[model samples]
Target chain A: MFDISFENAKLFKDCVDAIVNLINEGEFEISSEGITLRAMDPSQIAMVDFKMPKKACSSYKVEGDVKIGVNFEDLSRVMGRARPEESLNLKLKDSRLEMTFKGKFTRRFNLPLLDIGGTVPKEPKIEFDANIKLNASVLKDSLKDASLVSSHVVLSIDKNSFVIEATGDRGDVLIETKKEETVVIAHECTNNAKAMFPLEYLNDILKGADSSTVITLYLKTDAPLKVEYPVGQAEIVYYLAPRIENV
Target chain B: MFDISFENAKLFKDCVDAIVNLINEGEFEISSEGITLRAMDPSQIAMVDFKMPKKACSSYKVEGDVKIGVNFEDLSRVMGRARPEESLNLKLKDSRLEMTFKGKFTRRFNLPLLDIGGTVPKEPKIEFDANIKLNASVLKDSLKDASLVSSHVVLSIDKNSFVIEATGDRGDVLIETKKEETVVIAHECTNNAKAMFPLEYLNDILKGADSSTVITLYLKTDAPLKVEYPVGQAEIVYYLAPRIENV
Candidate 1:
């Protein structure tokens, strides 16, 4: 038997929302310590690593370590109905997952579990040259600004500032946040790093992050970008492959 | 030369938004008293009469009475850029309308006037049996509820209550606000009145009214419906022809 409950449903809902854009289905591993999910997008261009510690839940119980496959789309639809003031409970029953929301009125929904078949991809090991922590809104706004001119943006970091620039037929957009700005919480660099990434994937990766969230980004020249942020007590990390420009 | 300024751009923006959905282009008759526009939708089933008294403007100046044609789409686009704290200024420059927003920074846009050639249609005269004044949110919520089940809804009024009901293959939805309810501020009915109306048009008509605004509705057995509401110091009225049902 497995059961879990949350004092506020927003945490669980937000966790699912973070990855729903990159993947439609995922396998969640539940253990005595916590829950974790590692999945790669269908295009194999990005991978998501999600972790929810047992302490995040008000109550958690497990008989044994188990993995359950769920359709993210359907889960998102159910989570969308949760109100901020409501508590949520989840129980595994035979072949279905029973979800209950408690507040002024009790609402229940039963979703069928799927038998997913696939091996989880291993996280890549990389040595980063620079790490920057900044407000999520800064990144979100810069991505939107870049999208106006091009489909991809070049993210570069130096000792002085972090810059996002894009150029196209219409015009060019450049957003530079200097190290002295309050929006840049922390900045460090051993060597200057620059890489080009698809704006669409970056937008989807940032969708789950709130504007106030402080996000840490690890960067290296011509390598996948690592982003880490916290949702409630949970931690979510994403690695996006860089686009190579052919001269 | 004509010049007008608003302390808050929201009033002018909302006024344009109210009619942008119904008509694409309209002719504004500007005079010392105020500005007025009367136009019919492409289908000619609904007519909108919009009036903004000179008192609503912070400053109003005009050399003489003038009629200028404007594309609602372009005006809406420009108005949308106005921030809440910004003040809006309008001036007639030759064949173009110059809009300037003054706030933390100044931004200007020039929209060319169109030669709109259609004559304004006269408002229809009708005798109604009932007049009800209720909160705008009540009507907006009722229309949304009816849209779930059917494309058309029956609005009826009697001495006791105001009812909106719709039925379709999926199911039926009925929302009733009684005379004692705080939502209904005033109710008067000499004879029972009922009429069927297309939900799409009703939704468009209510889109401009804020939830806190009180709206007055005049209804008849099988006649055009008249709705009146206020936006800032401006008053907007709409007349919609009821759909006659065949037995």
Candidate 2:
């Protein structure tokens, strides 16, 4: 028997929200050191990596490594129902999983762990060509406007400016804000790169972000886009598959 | 040519919200003297009757009887997008209904009123038998809890007690709060009566209630029930058909 507690439930909420947006479910391995799992989606389009260390918890008590495949959608739903003021408890009940929130309510659900198909392996450590730090609120606002006009958006970054553009049958929307325009930007990329990506997936990954949260974006030409934001005490890394342009 | 300006959009929102919940999409006759509407849904399961006098507005300006048959639903949707801080302009554009709200930005939408059936017939004045005056907030809470257990609720009143009961396949919920149980027994009815009404219909009528705004309920056994709540400067009366129980 082992127990760990969090001062706030939002940290867990952000992690679940970010992962659920990227993948419906994934393999999670909890060991004596910490919990770690990394995988790319079916199309080899995006990869999601999660790490929740024991030291991050008030109590980091563990005896062995347990690799459990969890359907984050189901777990997120259960966690979503938890009241803000209540403390969350996770435990094993026979073969089912038990979650108790507060001292008042408890829910038990069973999950089947499947052998996640062929191991496509993780991405190679390639240095990102462009790195930019931006406010989540600004990016969120820009995405909202772009999504209104198109299904897929093209993001362009230059040494001095970052641009988001979406054009469709309805209308065209373009949002460009420079580092020196009003906000601070320290972009070093001399050349410009553009890639198209789905808007729905991007919006979902930013669901739990607030105005004050800093969103760091990493990019390379024709490569998966990476968006990283910290939620509560957890760090969430979201990778999105790029849409191929018509030749 | 008709134009009206409201500094705060919420006044219009509150009026539309209360009006929409009580009635189905129907024709509303707008004039310089007052606005009037009366119609029953196609199914005849419910009926909504609305009236707003010229005295309710800041300026009572009119020249002719402008009977524009407005679709309540379309008007509600347009009103839903108005922000409270924005200045709202209601204008007739080329005889087409248009509303422009100016906030951080200007957003204009056009809504065409549909021809709904029926006209507001002269209401036959009737004296209500029993009246109970209570805060809208208190009643809304009671209905919310009772709805959790059943779809049909029974409302009863004794000499000094107010009782609400709802029972379904799941379980039963009962709420009994008396005048003496609190402090105020403004009026009491010695003859006790209970009437059952649909929960969803009741929910609609109570949607725009303000906690501080008092709601007066007029009830009669085997007859329709009427609930009157105050909007900013107008009185909204919601009439609902009651379900009869065979003794």
TM-score of chain A of each: 0.98, 0.86
- Against the hidden true structure, what lDDT does model 2 obtain? 0.69
lDDT of 1 by residue, B133-203 (tens): 98899899889889999999999999999999999999999898898898889999999999999999998
Total backbone collisions, model 2: 0
Candidate with the greatest lDDT versus the true structure: 1
Candidate 1 structure quality by residue, lDDT tens digits, A68-117: 89999999999999997999998998779899999999999999998987
Worst 10 residues of 1 chain B by lDDT: B102-111
C-alpha positional error of residue A99 in candidate 2 after TM-score superposition, expressed in Å? 19
Worst 10 residues of 2 chain A by lDDT: A181-190
Show pairs that collide, candidate 1: none
Top-TM-score candidate index: 2
